[model samples]
Target chain A: MNFDDAVRLTEILLGFAFAQQSIEHFKSFPNEQRLFIPRFVLAVLLMIGFQTAWVAGLLFLSGLAMLHRFQGPYNGGSDRMSLLVLFCLCLVYLAPTQRWQEIAFGYLALQLVFSYFFSGWVKIVNPEWRSGRALCDVFQFSVYPASESLRQWSKSPRVLFVMAWGVMVFELIFPLLLLSRISLVIALIVAAGFHFANACLFGLNRFFWIWISAYPSILWFQLRFITAN
Target chain B: MFHILKLLLPAVIPSWRFFDVIAPSPRIQFALLNSANAPSDNDYEWCEFRPRPAHLSFLQMLGRMFWNPERNESLFLVSCAERIVQQPTQHSEDEILKRIIAELKTNHSDSTGETTHLQFRLLLVQRQDSRLQQQVVFHSRIQSLSTQDKT
Candidate 1:
């Protein structure tokens, strides 16, 4: 197929994949078959406010998780590790301020900061991802079956390089927005862009939708929705 | 009591775990208790690690919808295969492929000779091999392949 045809075909395939995964995701109500459920659930819950309690419960639980991490039985943290984690996370669960700006900035900063640090950590381990060559290979692996005959632009190294740089720049800068006055808005746009790119470039449809869906609350700053309990 | 001991002694000393399971797919599970004298057999370990599906997340959902379409086909393809097969049996991948191919051949017309079946069997082997080299998700390839077999 031509470029347009390829794009359309990919969309159909993505839909099939999404429906399949969605069926599995909701099979027994929120399967941990994947990582990043927070991002997944939040991106999708972007539209509706009628289900305010559901979101509150989710954020409350996430805050609780932060608390539990340092104090629970599975807490295998060292003295220093425990102290450092507990100090930062306590602000999330117990802090008194409920301002839209602070809550939005803080929550967005925390989630992206954590994800950025972890993701950057993994990327740093591999030199190729940083330089952009590694990403090209990842794309090639997806279309390898028909790589010889097919017409996906992702097969090109230059495209992968631009993508790799885009990802790296976003990760490097996405957390900074959390510290700024207009940081929440910027971060929401970047997160949306990041997920949308994944949908277009890779066959990672669930990642795109779930991540985008979660963007609604983050997009509009509100301590009330972010912290239900 | 003596006969029972005789049976128990041989089984216990054999140094393997044998568990017979009766499910939709009736089968036996066995493991080696002592690797020192473990019976060297192919059935001991099939998949080094069981099939792990792609991660589930909002980000993952997004990836599926907008990015990785080909990656998504495997999910439906697996469901399609599951629906096609009446009796589910867990066997060697090759054996499963062979059985499905035979079923497809039987469903075809007499005008189509056994050559079609041979072509299908060959295609499955090639696809299976290519998947290993290229890392095609098992779920997507399985159904697509079986459909190729049937068609």
Candidate 2:
């Protein structure tokens, strides 16, 4: 699909993800009383594909409140990704025309690109990450390790180094892959596998869905900026 | 400019300490031990009421969310524990532990109907070669609970 279609699809998926994460009463009943009502309303609007300015405004606020309510983003990357999508969608609905809406989507794409490059660059500069010890340590001491067998992979220095370097290179080169359709497709596949492994081994299920929701934005960016030419 | 800043600030800011730029060596783990000195694997066990949904299926995302060990409750407690450990002063440690004990007593009293002392401990866990090693870097003195705390 094209950029507009991609934006719409992402909004729908993000709405569902937010709804699932928020359905339970994470805060005490009295504490959540103010947030509970607005959140459900926002979820309903997004689910039904309604993107009015009011809805958007409420969603943007409720997303912030939910993150705050959860004691400031306990889920880490998933929280950040959700906020990015919510903020962009709010802008999309508030924009006066299709052109302006696309601009909002483009901003989301840039943020996603920056997130990948920033995370990878930091890892590259870190001594532990460069030595492959970071990946090994994660597997060994992970609180949510899926099984003992999974953690055993840390035993092999060669495997650890390759996997560590693989992650760093993939993330560092992620933005470059957006310039070509074939390369973007390959990168997307590799990225999906990476998230899948993380979800399975580390139980970071929310990260898997939230990050994938941002993929369409990158795809839209490529279509608008590169493939059209 | 305002709109742009709004979109960028949260994205640029690191939301969770775990997602910090630098992955430190020898990560930390938090554990709660009962007065009997036995460690319970379930963190929620100490909480008076474990949060659950109307239906288990709607709450369980792909049967994985429920099993996620890194629940927000524990993460929040860990953050609090980290702050307490950083000071390493008797007065500060006592203050933090007192606050934590009060929280536990308030939250975990009614449902469990069990009176037990609890201690919060932080473990410095590291991996070397094929083995994982851990030691208690910081541990709170046990906070004993009275039967009267069974609110």
Candidate 3:
């Protein structure tokens, strides 16, 4: 993927994510509700790639305002990822040189890969995660489960163990996916599916969109360096 | 510069450590109290605030991907409660308490006759040895309650 294609793809995906988030914020804190209109407008402008640099800059500012309103991120990891993407996109547009733009987007892509690897690293180090106890606990007791019926999966320890290891191994080896085109496609698909399932079972819908928004940068990064090599 | 950095730090930095370990989940439970600063006899049982729905239709689940204000609000409350549990401070506690009271007032606007005060507690629920265990992590002092708009 060329740089422009990557940027466009990222913009479209991030726009959808931001638009949805703006609507969610309407039902959030009273102070935050005031931001919904600007955010929604910026999101639409972003999707259309209208005045790309200016729109991204304004969106970045809006994102910071949102951060201030919440005192941090209202939603933890998902909000963090969204901010990171916006920051990078802002730089991508405003950078004086193409090299700088590439560098900025590269940083975003690298962080995306590192996020998965680090998450898996931490989980593997924790005994509960390795023994599948963590997954069982999440299903049985975590407030994240979308419905009471979903908690029934906690009863099957064997299934939980397999699923837990499956997730950990996939995440741990995520960076390796960048080594080849075919592997990258498979990795993105698996990661999307993982996020999709989390949204379905845990009601973590935000994570699904925010994480997927960064995929274009990953695709661009791999094609630029790994495939060229 | 230092103050600006402190304000910006939480939003800019990403902590990718998600679900790294198993821990008990926090649940908010509140009880209605009578005028004497005690739980009313008739309302002795603590009701769970914003309990998760038992089920959602397939369409509702699909639609949530686009817009899910209620679930997001619930998650935000959980985040607030978790912060208080992790580090208790007057400000954090008071902030959550105020929000909880406001939510209760909005939801139970009809409770004007019997309940005059409200008390809430945080319960950490975890599974231990094939059974559920609940531990009270924090409890608040009884506060006056009124369904009438204070504004």
Report the number of the highest-TM-score candidate.
Answer: 3
User: What tens digits encode model 3's per-residue C-alpha lDDT throughout B1-151?
Assistant: 3643565564456668889877789998877777645644345668888788888877878899888877887787788788889886564555556666777666767753577777778999987787899988988767776542232
Error of 1 at A160 (Å): 2.9
Error of 2 at B84 (Å): 4.9
**Candidate 2 per-residue lDDT over residues B1-151, each given as its tens digit:** 3544454476545432333232222223223444556554455243311222223232343466434532433334444445555656554344345545555556655632454665555655555555656665665665665422221
For A35-88, candidate 3 gives per-residue lDDT tens digits of 877898899999998997898888888877766555566787888888889989
- Measured by TM-score, how close is model 1 to the native structure? 0.39
Model 1 lDDT tens row, B1-151: 3533442332112221111110021111122122223333443332211122433455544434534423443322232333334333332233334434443345433423422222110111111322423221132112232243221
lDDT digits (tens) for residues A1-229 of candidate 2: 6866887778777766666555544343455546755675677677677854566677777766655444345465676777778778778877899899889888888877777777788788888888887777776665445545666777887898998888888988988998789999899889878877776665577777777787888888888887887
Chain A vs. true chain A, TM-score per model, equals: 0.46, 0.86, 0.97
What ordering of candidates by DockQ runs from best to worst? 3, 2, 1
Would you list the C-alpha lDDT of every candidate in the order shown?
A: 0.36, 0.63, 0.83
Native contacts kept (model 1):
0.11
Q: Give each prediction's root-mean-square deviation over alpha carbons.
A: 17.9, 7.1, 2.7
> Per-chain TM-score of chain B, candidate 1?
0.24
List the candidate 3 regions with Cα displacement exceeding 4 Å: A27-29, B1-4, B10-13, B36-43, B98-108, B111-113, B128-131, B147-151
